[model samples]
Target: MPDVKFKHVVSCSSEDPKNPAANLVAQEAFRKWKGVAGQPSVSVILQLEKSTKVRALDIGNEFSAFIEVLVGKSTDTEDAYH
Candidate 1:
């Protein structure tokens, strides 16, 4: 959402140089985040600036077959995504 602000990218598997992961949060529709070829799968972890409850998500990915959203706290373990 426009209210949410991302601090930085914690980690990312792949991303296009022209269209980086930061485009995902950008308001411009022309700019988009695209992964490189030859990869089995891709993943990106975007860290938020603050702890805020997300009631909903707006996913608009037509290129990928599927996408999974994982939410976790700074103190929670990897398995805590549920």
Candidate 2:
């Protein structure tokens, strides 16, 4: 199966500038997105070139136990993600 590449990072709940959320979508995919230390949970909103249904995902875990993925459309308003 082909990989789903993201168009860009829409909004990130919390991220360490050193390792930005955008790195997760980078073509290289060498870098990882890191949240600021002490945060309980981090959320990220990403845009795709078109609508896509993800059947599988390949991830390299570091210190995380579980991951959640959310899918939605983007509106013109700031609260586009729903």
Poorly placed runs, candidate 2 (over 4 Å): 75-82
Candidate 1 Cα outliers beyond 4 Å, as residue runs: 25-31
The TM-score between candidate 2 and the true structure equals 0.75
**Residue 17 Cα positional deviation in candidate 1, in Å, after optimal superposition:** 1.4
- Report the Cα lDDT for candidate 2: 0.78
Question: How many clashing residue pairs appear in each of the predictions shown?
Answer: 0, 0
lDDT of 1 by residue, 24-75 (tens): 6575665467788667698888888899988887777756777999889878
The global C-alpha lDDT for each of the candidates, from Candidate 1 onward, is 0.77, 0.78
TM-score of 1: 0.75
**Candidate 2: worst 10 consecutive residues by lDDT?**
73-82
lDDT of 2 by residue, 4-76 (tens): 8788987899999888998978889475888898777877887988888888877565577777765667645
Candidate of highest lDDT: 2
lDDT of 2 at 47: 90
